[model samples]
Target: MPKLNIFVGTMYGGALDVAEQVKPLFEQAGFDVTIFEQPMLEDLIQHKTDVALFCVSTTGSGDFPGNFVPFVRAFHEQGPALSELRYGLIALGDSSYGETFCGAGRALDALLEDHGATRLGERLEIDAMETFMADDEAVPWVEQWIDSQQLKAA
Candidate 1:
């Protein structure tokens, strides 16, 4: 089995909380999981991971979280390409952010995919101002994503 790399790029802790919620599932599935509280894409595997989940929260006006600025930039412009890797993303945000709710996740997912990474799952987005828990929204998506990856691997 291939190791799964989880990149938690967040500001208000929502993304980190999401990662914590999903940790058990990854462990049970026997994936060697590596986490980055603050990610630098160049430092994390690009083409090496079977699946890399980027959990992020959008900041002011659809901007990248402060901790993720460098990574978001490098992953889009200066980092090693992820063409050989399969990846997924989850975005956490307040719908009040309006025009660009979950913008960070959307951008990263698209940028990575554009550079040739195979996007393996339907990227999820959750609004903090909504009526449900963010982790809850991500759980099923993660499960479905994992299942698809398993099929691909087999």
Candidate 2:
């Protein structure tokens, strides 16, 4: 059975809410899902899941949320290659921030790629400046991604 892990880095809790919204959908697809808020690097290093989904909100100046600092630091210091991991990212940002919009997500995605993880699909960037919330886009994206995964499996 393939396992799925959700790790969220949030300021003001919006990304966490989005992650919670998607948990059941992954479960319904037969993935054993585990969710974490601002997970530690050690936890990620030892994760048993085959797939990882990140729901992260960029903070001021496009920085990672405060709670993500330790994890990011540890990963840069000595994280091993995640050669067997498959991952996806849902970046929550306000497009009004201009170039820095979704910076944290892009940084994390780059880190994951540097560590050799395979991205499951295009990184989903949700604009908080839009009329709709991030989950609006995320929900449908997850549905489609799941459908594609199922098709590939078949």
Candidate 3:
């Protein structure tokens, strides 16, 4: 079985809530799972996991939550190539923000792709403006995502 590592960035905790909710599902799918909140670049670079999951929220004006700013900078400025990585991303934001909605997630997703990381599937974007409760909407979406990948949840 492969490992699944979950990382999240959030303001007011919405993205963190979604990460916690999905952790066990990955574990049940026979992955050795680890979760991080506003992780450092070293935290991601050191791990040799088969899959990395990101749940990140866009903060004011599309900025990354304060805790994640350093990680984002390091990812763009100093992170190593990640050709062996496979990933999934969950972008949490209010559609009312228009162009900036989920900007942090999109930025990270592009960063990873640029470094040669492959996506497990399409990124999941939860619209807080539409759902009111982002985490609630994320649960089934994640389950279906795992299923769509044809991954066995042992």
The best candidate by lDDT is 2
lDDT (Cα, 0-100) at 99 in candidate 1: 86
What TM-score goes with each of the models? 0.88, 0.94, 0.94
lDDT of each: 0.78, 0.87, 0.86
Window of ten residues with lowest summed lDDT in model 2? 145-154
In candidate 2, what are the lDDT values of residues 1-154, reduced to their tens digit? Answer: 6788899999899899899999888888888889888699877778798788999989998899987888899999997789988888999999999999999999999999999999887999999888367778888899888887562222
What is the TM-score of candidate 3?
Answer: 0.94
Error of 3 at 6 (Å): 0.5
Candidate 1's residue-wise lDDT over 1-154, tens digit each?
A: 7678888978888888899888667767777777788778765654356678888989998888999998877765765656677777888878887889888888887788777888775778888887367888887777777787673332
Residue-by-residue lDDT tens digits, candidate 3, 14-71: 9888999988888777888888886888988897787889999999988889888888
- Regions of candidate 2 where Cα sits further than 4 Å from its true position: 151-154
- Return the clash pairs for model 3, or none: none
Model 1 residue pairs with clashes: none
